[model samples]
Target: MPLVEINFDGLVGPSHNYAGLSLGNLASASHGGDPSYPRAAALQGLGKMRHNLNLGLAQGFFAPLPRPNGAFLDALGLSGVEPAGEAERRLRAAAWSASAMWTANAATVSPAPDTADGRCHLTAANLVTMPHRSQEWPDTVRQLRLAFADTAHFAVHDAVPACFGDEGAANHMRMAAHHAAPGLEIFVYGRHTKDTGGGAFPARQHEQASRAVARLHGLNPAQALFVEQSAEAIAAGAFHNDVVAVANERVLFTHELAFADPEGTYAAIRAAQPEAEIVVVPASAVSLADAIASYLFNGQVLTLPGGAMGLVIPLEAWEHPRVRAYLDGLLASNGPIRKVLPVDVRQSMANGGGPACLRLRVVADPAAIDPRFLLDEARIALLESVVAAHWPEQIDPTDIGSAALARSVQAARAAVLEAAGLTELA
Candidate 1:
């Protein structure tokens, strides 16, 4: 087989909690101060991975980043002491965030066929729009380097400058006849460098940042299309483009209000890949509110082993009346997407992520990547055992600063690293 798309999920960390640091993420804001179950969250994520693996898809994983980031807290002048104020406490919470588990925000990847060089390229996302996510790229780049260390097959770049915020694959999409083919790369941005739009919420992806990533990855100018995400979508809590839109192979599954100009966007996509199958769910059938709430569009639309496309959605989308009706109609219509497999990811959903958010898609041969980062039956069992033994059963927001929790979180992560033989990341 030629290069194949591998879904690399981020293993949910022991520090998983709900501090609600993300400004525009409605689920995070709504679930603030709510108790979180880290063990359940990690297990849910692992189960999703197992589901895909069983479907005969290529699966890989990135380990959780170091948390209770002492260096970050120290830089903020709050190290080695208890937080004395609400502002200081917020900083501590940010430091302890397990937000890195959402690997979709980890990097922007351009496969070998699309890039100038014959090697696949990945650039870590700067994530400068939110303070909590801003601290992610450095550690993200470290892991990217280790995983894609095969210089002949991959080239990993650090993030573009922080002046323009980049949210990685969350605001990007690729369309091709097949995973191995050179494809049209779409970089979606929420704001222009000079414009201050996005209404109540900040536009996280900058047009300039998207362009920078395209350049860094050495994508062909004509093959790269830069589109602006609609302000309405952003205000509706589609914090990233993936919230309202997702593309796999030649199909674009999106909400009606996903883009600023849906028709033009579709036209451009069809122009680039004439075989592109666009399945748009009208707002009447499933409103943007319902789409975002249920994360209907946040599911992974993947080509199954049997050649039919399957949508890996969250259980929330399955239970949603409008979303479910639309999906049923889609399946009945004999459309490109045939299967709607919903898995439980309630823990991640409550924290503002879904199946798509939990993964970073990389198109490459499994042999070209580090085997340790890849998943198998044995690896899955090992990971499940580690999470069951070490991950915190539940984490209250107030537990962010507890010394015992911090020790447990750190020790848990260390154990996972040791078990995986990836202690170098520790």
Candidate 2:
């Protein structure tokens, strides 16, 4: 059986709001307290899925976990306690966070071909870098178990210990000759505690955590390349590796400064995969500022049905003069990326997520995945209608603590789950 990369996108939860929770994320801080349009956000995501489906790419959906998470509050010793002070305010803010909508941080996946067990392995991310997001793993694991439950085809493991922060696929990249073949898995981390190449931004993924994941999947150390993320990139708001670099099959599209040592990193990747295609976008052509602002590298690079590659980017990229010109040049030339498709995901963009952030890439047979999580035209119609009818048009920061808002979010999620015949997950 032939294997292919399937994009499993997280349904933007109704709790989607801008509370400015993530310290390193530029968009989250810039748009803090802004009114969020949940209905529009979700529909935009579903539209992207539909577009991919029409393009004959395999697309999947990961259900949003119920929010206003009481468990998280209870762990912090705040649940069941009435709000009377700043601590309560902070706790409440964390409770209403829609951070889970960026499912790229959900888990680190080792496709069946890469793992020793021959079963695709996924370990939920601990996400300990941010307070609100730290609470996602438990629910994310539950959803993962349901979506990829076949023991013969999938192995869903618990998150790594909390002491070691793990941000999942956001910091991981893979490349192979083909989806089913053995490949190189690159885990990018920040500066080590002992090595003092510094930055103010937090390093979300720990090297120890990455090693733990590799061992859990029984991956050979030679095939697993652990590279340090450039402190410069982190300072520039490339908080995750996906922000600076992205890979599909044998090609690596990245900014020159994506790694601590560009020369060494490129050599290592090439050494691992002899036929690797590395496309480095120099800062001279498009400043790192423009790349970060436009999320140019966050675009999804897919091997289209016709054997050509397409870069599915956000509208922001097309609007940026420098980045747009660069993309146009690449297309005009005989580059690996043959086309550029711009998508509208302004709602997620406003909150610091782009096309890549919305999806988790899993290399597997579509038939091996649970049928309920896969999407079709009819399923998309049902999801779109549910979002249109039940999702809130706007959710303000002040609305985070509203009991009515919580109930509404739950109702909307339940409706979508029912529509997808995934009520068991609900």
Candidate 3:
């Protein structure tokens, strides 16, 4: 009955490029229109997966959602015919979107222990705030259904209605004594669709969306807690909850401005799990600007095999002086996070994602899940080889409309599908 938390990382899609699609994301806007190295990005992501696998953690992979989505274009009232105009250009942009690479937004997962059916449930995100990202849910739902298809162990639900924006696990967190234990489910919302309380940034995760997802999963209301994300964090570019906080097992590491009322939220979580540890980084020690810039809180505190914990962070944190000193102090002390490993996800980092943003945590009995989604040394090697040979080295924003680029991306995805024995997905 033991269940381990499995990290399902999104394979950086072959169309990975900077389109400056995210408005509130500082890095996304700052590095907009810059050329992106899709091959390098995918390889770095694969390397991270390999590192976790070596650490004796269960690792899973979600293939990039299909791009050049024609269905999306039709809905936008754009045709596929030639003699294309501005409308066609905009449509092609959505089709070539690689934002699907951030799988943390893929779905909100309710582990077997938290669900009424005693089965894990997943709801694909309806990323309605961003036009490019809004096109992802249908394809993401398809991918989720395929990856977690075992009905005996899993339930895959369609996204909530598009009227209410839902950003999935990026806005959800669960804290339990063990992966399989019934625990606290924290749903963080920024604004309601009708209420524009998000200050400077558009609040993507609606309270209604979170409530609907919890209802769909049949989560016990007593165990579920809904919280509003701080407008300060949102205005400061903490676009998602994972951007300001991350949780694993019994620990929740977050910044001071993560919630509207940090103290009250922490107390509720404590009431649920009296033994829960909440690590808050004071605003004076690290300003919200620096925290978002370095993505300090985005680091994952993974429980190693011997019960010790390690902090998996992006190289950006090591480069930030204040953040680096804080991390050093934590490791130097007798804290639960004993190890600090800096990974090179510079490509994703440049586009406003960090180590935490690349993954979706699914706590389940590995034996009960689909085997093809799991990865090992051999599969990692195969994925790396396929990416190097097929993924485009660089994709400029201008290249998003290129038919050749779109074809190359689809072909690269097909190669990965073939390697994973998921030709049906291809």
Which candidate has the top score in TM-score? 1
lDDT of 2: 0.89
Q: Candidate 1 residues 1-426, lDDT tens each?
A: 579999999999999999988999999999999999999999999999999999999999999999989889889987877888877878889999999999999999999999988899999999998888899999999999999999999999999989988999999999999999999999999864246442778889989989998998899898999998888899889999999999999999988899888899999999889999999999999998999999998999999987899999999999999888988899999989989999999999999999999999999988989889999989999999999999999998778889999999999999999999998899
lDDT of 2 by residue, 64-153 (tens): 887888777777787767678876776788888877888899999999888898999999999998888898998899889988888899
Model 1 poorest 10 in a row by lDDT: 191-200
Look at candidate 2 and tell me the lDDT of residue 423.
84
Estimated TM-score per prediction?
0.98, 0.97, 0.96
Instruction: Report the poorest 10 consecutive residues by lDDT, candidate 2.
Output: 191-200
Every candidate's CA RMSD: 1.2, 1.4, 1.9
Model 3 weakest 10-residue run by lDDT = 191-200
lDDT of 3 by residue, 1-426 (tens): 588899999999998888777879999989888999999999999999999999999999998877777677677665455426754665567667778888899999999899999999999999999888998888788878887788998999999999999999999999989777898999999964246443667889999999999999999999999999988898899999998998888999899899999999999999999979888888888899999999987777899998988889999998899998888887887776789888999999999999988999998888877788999999999999999999999998778767798789889989988988888776
Q: What is the lDDT of residue 175 in candidate 1?
A: 97
Backbone clash pairs for candidate 1 read: none
Q: In what order do the candidates fall by lDDT, top score first?
A: 1, 2, 3
Ordered from best to worst TM-score, the candidate numbers read 1, 2, 3
Of the two candidates 1 and 2, the one with more favorable TM-score, higher being better, is 1
